[model samples]
Each structure stands twice: as C-alpha cells, then as structure tokens.
Target: MEFFAVLIAWGAVQFWGSGAIVQSDDWFVALRRSLRKINGAVPRLLLTLSPLLLVALVLFLLGPILFGLPAFIISVVILLYSLGRGDFHIQLRLYLNSWQRGDLEGARRHGEYFDPELRTGAENALQLHQAVRKGVFYHGFERWFAVVFWFFLAGPVFALAYRLLFLIARHEDSEQRERDMAFQGLYYFEYLPARLLGFAFALIGHFDRCFPVWRQLSVAELPSDDYLDQLGATCLPGVSAEEAQDDSAFLQRASDELQAAQQMLSRSLLCWVGVMALIELF
Candidate 1:
C-alpha cells in the first residue's frame, strides 16, 4: 500500500509538475509565524510539529476505515506535498538553454535562482555552471530521494516531518536557535539517506570512480549537499582547466557536465524505484 502510494505520488508529480495545486508553503509560513509568538523553544517546536502530530492522529483514526483507503489517500497527498517545491527540470532547462546560447550572464542569472551564493562564488561561466550542477544534484536528493527514503522507511508522517524541519532550517525569518535546532535534526535525518543515494549513484553511474568517493565519505559528518557534490563530481567525466580556458570550449564542457548530471539523477532515481519494487516483491 505504501509502495503504491509512492508510485502514485511520484507519477502525479511527474505528470503535473509542481504546480501551486501540488505544492505550497504559504500555510506553513503562516503557521510558523503564529507559532513564533509562543514563549519557549519546546512549545514552539511542538507547535511547529503540531501539523504532523495531527496528521499522525488522523492517520491512526483512518487506519481501520475502508481497509485503510482513507489513510492511503492522505499518505499520497502528504508525500506529494512533501516533494521538493519547484519544477527542477524546468529550472535546469532554462539554465541550460542560456548556457547553450553562449549567454553566460543569462546562465548565471538562472543559476542564481537555484543558489544565490553562486552570484558571489563563481568566477566564470564554467565555475557557475558547475556550482549549479552541484546545486541540482543536492536539490534532487533533498526534494526527491530524501523524502522517498523517509516515506518508505516510516511513512508519510516522518516524510512530512522531514519537510517541515527543512523549511525551518532554511527559512530566512526563523529564529537563529530554531534554525540551529532544525538543522541539527535534519543532519541526523539525512545522514543515512544521503549515503544510500550515493551508493545508488555508484551503481548506476561510473562505479569505479564513484565507489571510492562514496566509501571515503560514508562515515564523514559532512553535510548532504557537500557529500553528494563530491560523489557527483566523481561520477562525471573530468574537465581540465586547459579545456575550459576558451569561452566556447568552457561553455560546451559546462553544458555537457550539466546534461550528465541530469542523466545521472534520472538513472539513480529509476534505480531506487526498481530496488523498492524488488523489496516489496520479495
């Protein structure tokens, strides 16, 4: 039932993309604002999680209804809502189109939509695109892989909890202490799933290249984004500084790398779904 719920939710997202009907955080923002008026950390945290608690309570009540169909429907809805909040493919396409046209400035502007820090950190078009590549990989993991991992392991409740924590950690207006605590929670939650996704990358991508990096970073306390970036870099063909010295060559190479990253993400996701299906079968 959980597996079917996942399949349905995944299919819906792919078919419809992340339209406002399927994804929105405005309610969460409003809830957080109300919760912030509370007096203490414990109360605020509990209030922040109150939605998940309510969800769990409702699922519990619905578990015995109509052979759990109601619970299943709610699970799919929550999972859909829990997915990464944007149309990643569209964003990637816009960025790539800009890169392909030799519009470095336009590409950088598109990349900035993904990582505002790219504006300051990237020295050239190649560097900016590479940073965007890493950002893409990280977003793929966070928005899809991590959410699916929690959903499969625990159910929709934990998946929703993970998303809630992510929002708190990344929210600009969140209190410093609240953000810190949320980040800490996410660190622990994402640890295993991130490594597992890296392992999947190794299997479906350049195994000889990716495996060693995966093994080395397996036990490290590095954040998920950094860890996945390192693994993703290894999975792709290397680009030398000399190859990127010229404008045309650098843009082409960066475009190739971004395409490679997209393919790797797609393959890894298919691999994960296959593994999940096999697990359910046997």
Candidate 2:
C-alpha cells in the first residue's frame, strides 16, 4: 500500500506540476498566527503540530475500514501534500534562459529566487552562479528526495512532519528562536536522508569520484546543502573549478553544469524508485 501510494503520488505530481490545490499553506499560516497568541513554548509547539496529530488520528481511525482502502487513499493525499511547494523545473528553466543569454544581472536576479540569501552575498557573477548551482542541488534534495525518504522509511506522518518543519524554518515571520528550533529539528530529520541521497548520486553519477566524498562526509556534521554541493560537484560529468575560471565561456559551462546537475537529480530519483520497487517485490 505504501509503495502504491508513493507511485500514485509521484505520477500525480508529474501530471499536475506542484499540486497547488493540495500544497496550499494558507491554513498553516493561519494556524501559526493563532498559535502565537498562546503562552508557553510547549503549548505553542503542540498547537503547531496539531495538524499532523489530526492526520495521524484520521489514519488510525481509517486503518481497518474497507480493508485499509480509505487509509491508503489518505496516505496518497498526504504524500502529495508533503511534496515540495513549487514547480522546480520551471524555475530552473527561467534561470537557465537568463544565464544562456549572457545576462549576468538578470540571472543573478533569477537565482535570488532560489536562495534569497544570494541577494546579500555573491560578490561576482561567478560566485553568484556557483551559489545558484548549490541552491539547485539543495532544493532538489529537500523538495523531493528528503520527502520521499521519510515517506518510505516511516509513512505519511513523518513526511508531513518534515515538510512542516521545513515551512517553519523558512517562514520569514517566524520568531528567531522558533526558527532556530525548527532548523535544529530539520537537521536531525535530514541527516540520514541527505547521506542516502548522496549515496544514490554516487551510484548514478561518477561513482569513483563521488563515492569517496560520500563516505568521507558520512560522519561529518556538514549541513545538508554543503554536503550535497560537495558530492554533486564531484559527481557531475564536466563540472570542475577550472571551468568556472574561464572568462570567455564560463556562462556556457555554468549552464551546462546546471543542466547536468538537474539530470543527476532526476537519475538519482529514478534510482531510488527502482530500489523501492525491488524492495516491494522481494
């Protein structure tokens, strides 16, 4: 049932591109606002997690109904809702269009949408481009791989929890302390999945070059973004520091690298699905 839920949800996301109807966060924003009126950290935290609790309660109540058919349907809905909020491929296309046209400023502006922090840093076009590349890889991991990982490991509950924590951590109006705590929770949730995704990158990419980096970082406390950046750079076919140093063709090379990164991400996801199918079979 879990396998079928994942398969159906993956197909639905591909067909609908972002699944906006199920991915809406207006309710979350409202819930957060109401929770803010409560005193005490514990109470606020419990209120914040009430949605997840409600989901768990519903699944529990539905578990035995019609041989679990209703639960399966609910699982599919949760999985779809837990997916990343935006159309990543479209965003990548816009960034690439600006980049390939030799519009450095325009590309940087597009890149800022990927990582808002890019607005403050990235002294030059090269630096900005590199930051954008890292952003691309990180977004792919968090938006897809991480969600799928939790869903496969536990169920819809963990998947929803991961997405909720991500939203809290990234919420602009969230209190600093609340965001910090959410980030801490995210780190714990992401650690294992990040490593697993890195391993998948090694298998589907340049294994000889990427495997060593993956193994080396397995025990390190490196954040998921930096960890994926290191492994992704090593795995991509034509990516190298020297390519970025070339002034005349750097933009073209960066564009190619970005495309390669996207391909690697796709292949890694396929690899995971194949593995899961095998597991379901056996």
Candidate 3:
C-alpha cells in the first residue's frame, strides 16, 4: 500500500527540529497540545488505561486513511501534520527568550510550562510554572518519536494508538479509575517499541558508545514493563540495581541530569531514521 510506504517514509524523516522548523510542525503539535491542555492529569491518565480493543475501534474511525490512504498523500499529510503546534515553540521561545533577555521574571513565567503537580516547586522555580509545559514536553516526544514510531511499525495503527492513548490520558475526575486504566495500557503499549527505538538510536549514533549506555539504561529503573525490561536485558549488558536507581533518581530531579537521557533519545531517533534511509536505498 502506498499509504503504508508513506508511513514508512514519514517514519524515516527525522530532522532535529530547530527554532526555524517549529512553525512547520505547528499542526500536530497544536492538535496534541490542545487535547492535552484540556485533558490534564486525571483525564489523560484515564484514557491511557482504556481497553486496547476499544482504543482500536476509535483509531480505526479517525485514522482509517492511514491504513488505506494513498502513499503520496499520506506522505504529504504526515509531514504537514508533524510540524508542532500548541505552546511548545511559544513556550520554548518564552523560556529561551527570557533567559536571553535577562528577564528572570519573564523566564519564571515561561518556566510554568512544566506539570504543576510534578513541578511542585522550582528549587529553580522556573520549570514549575505550567502543567501544560509538561504537555509541551509530551508533545515534543509525541511528534518526535511516539507518533512516527507507530506509523512505521503498523501504519494507521500507530496513529490510532497515539490518538486513543492520548485521549485516555487527556480525561479527568470521578472517572479517575477509567483514567488509571487507560494510563496503565500506555505503559504496556510502548514497552517493546520504546526499546526498539532505543536500539535504533544506538545503531545510528556512536554505535559503540550508545550500545553500552543503552545496556546500562536497560537495567536503569527509568520506567516501563517486562517487555521493555527483557529487551533491555537482551540488548544491554547489565547494571547494579542500586546504581541504576540512583541514575534514575538523579535524572528525574535535574532536567540537566536528563542530558544523557535526551542524548539517548535523540540518538535513537536519528539512528532509526538513518537505518530506514539505508533500507529504502537498498
């Protein structure tokens, strides 16, 4: 199917988004960010926990074209859609701009983009400003990895899953139980694919360095299910539990500490794309 091929190409195109590229990705970013802004913790959590079958049904209706859509058109749409919207660039600019202008107050205001609950406080005070910001970060990951990863593996299935999972994650309240259920599934869904993505990163970047680090990440208590754990174990060497926990804890605290995690993530994205390019060339 051309659509399927389109999905593959879309998956392969992994340009690191610069300040200039933000406007182009405005669409997908906006769609997700808006849904997330409305959903918040309770709602989004519920959506993630929903039954996969139910999730499938919803995805089919909205993203049917993904499976059946023409490759050429699918290629165009995904690219158009991939451009981030929402407050991601706006917020990024705000924070960056504030820092550049020496606007501490401005920067603090911008920093509010992080999740309020998780943000609890800013020993820095800047990162804790908004839950939506976590939304921004989430959207960043969404467009950058989550959406495209699914698209390549199963075409429309990816689109449907992201939408369904995102919907569940976006809901709230008396429905907390439902939200929890939805949230739970997402944890399971990304289990295998996430590590596969990690492997792709290792392949593309400093393959030697990346592989060893990824092995370390496998044992590192970052998060996810047995599938993820198994994959990590198979691909990565091993790490002491205590040390991995410490690594996880440290990464969780300082966003700066996450530099390694970010590199790991980026390396994965770049490698996956580069590999796809190679496959297509062959």
- For residues 1-282, what per-residue lDDT tens digits would candidate 3 score against the true structure? 423454444444433332233224344344445545444555544333343455346545555565634444433454334333344445566565554555546655665553334434354333332233333334445554665566555654454455456454543322465456666766665655566665664664557766876676755645443323333233333333453346443223333322333444455666666665666666
lDDT of 2 by residue, 1-282 (tens): 778888898888789877566888999899888888787755776678778989999999999999999999989888888888788898889999988887777788788767888777668868887798899999898888898888988999999999998998888767777788888898999999899889998998878888888999878998899999888988885545786777657878888889999998998888888988998899
TM-scores of the models, in the order given: 0.95, 0.95, 0.52
lDDT of 2: 0.85
lDDT assessment of candidate 1: 0.86
**lDDT, candidate 1, 1-282, per-residue tens:** 778988898888878876336577888889888886788776787788889889999999999999999999889999998888878889899999988998878888888767778766577666786689779888889888899999998999999999999988888778888888998899999999999889988987778887988899988889988898888888888577887888778778878887888888888888888889998888
Using alpha carbons, what is the TM-score of model 3? 0.52
Range of the 10 consecutive residues with the lowest summed lDDT in candidate 2: 237-246
Which residue pairs show backbone clashes in model 2? none
Poorest stretch of ten by lDDT in candidate 3: 250-259
- Looking at model 1, the pairs that clash are none
Point out where model 1 deviates above 4 Å. Answer: 119-121
